[model samples]
Target: MKIDWKNKLTSRKFISAVTGVTIAVLAIFNVDNLTTEKVTALVSAIGLLAAYIVGEGYVDANRDK
Candidate 1:
């Protein structure tokens, strides 16, 4: 099966995935003395952001036409 990387690169999934990874990396490397509550909040925020990104893409794609 051929992988359509061009479309993948420009897709909402790609954006959200990259954003999530970036957030994880930032939290792991930049945060000092992390706690469970902080980690949970960070992950929850990322999930919400990712969902918003995907929902926005869907809305944009299906906007009045």
Candidate 2:
């Protein structure tokens, strides 16, 4: 089925799903307290953002080249 990008982006369902995954990861995978993992979480999140941007940029950059 074709996906609806506009509605998906605007929906609270997306936010709630991401929140649920984050809660599960922190609660189940985090051995230490959430406080101790705050920095690690931030860094990981940033790294993922960087990777996503780089991948997307690579595609769009080449497409326009």
Cα TM-score per model: 0.46, 0.44
Tens-digit lDDT track for model 2 on 1-65? 99976456434556456555666666776656765467446645654565566667668989998
Please give the distance, in angstroms, between residue 59's alpha carbon in candidate 2 and its true position after superposition: 0.4
Candidate 2 C-alpha error for residue 4, in Å = 36
User: Global lDDT of each model?
Assistant: 0.65, 0.61
1-65 per-residue lDDT for model 1 (tens digits): 99976456556667667666766776777665455346656766666676677667768989964
Sequence-dependent TM-score of model 1: 0.46
| lDDT score, candidate 2, position 43 | 49
- For candidate 2, list the clashing residue pairs, or say none: none
Clashes of each: 0, 0
Highest TM-score: give the candidate number: 1
Runs with alpha carbons beyond 4 Å of true place in candidate 1: 1-34
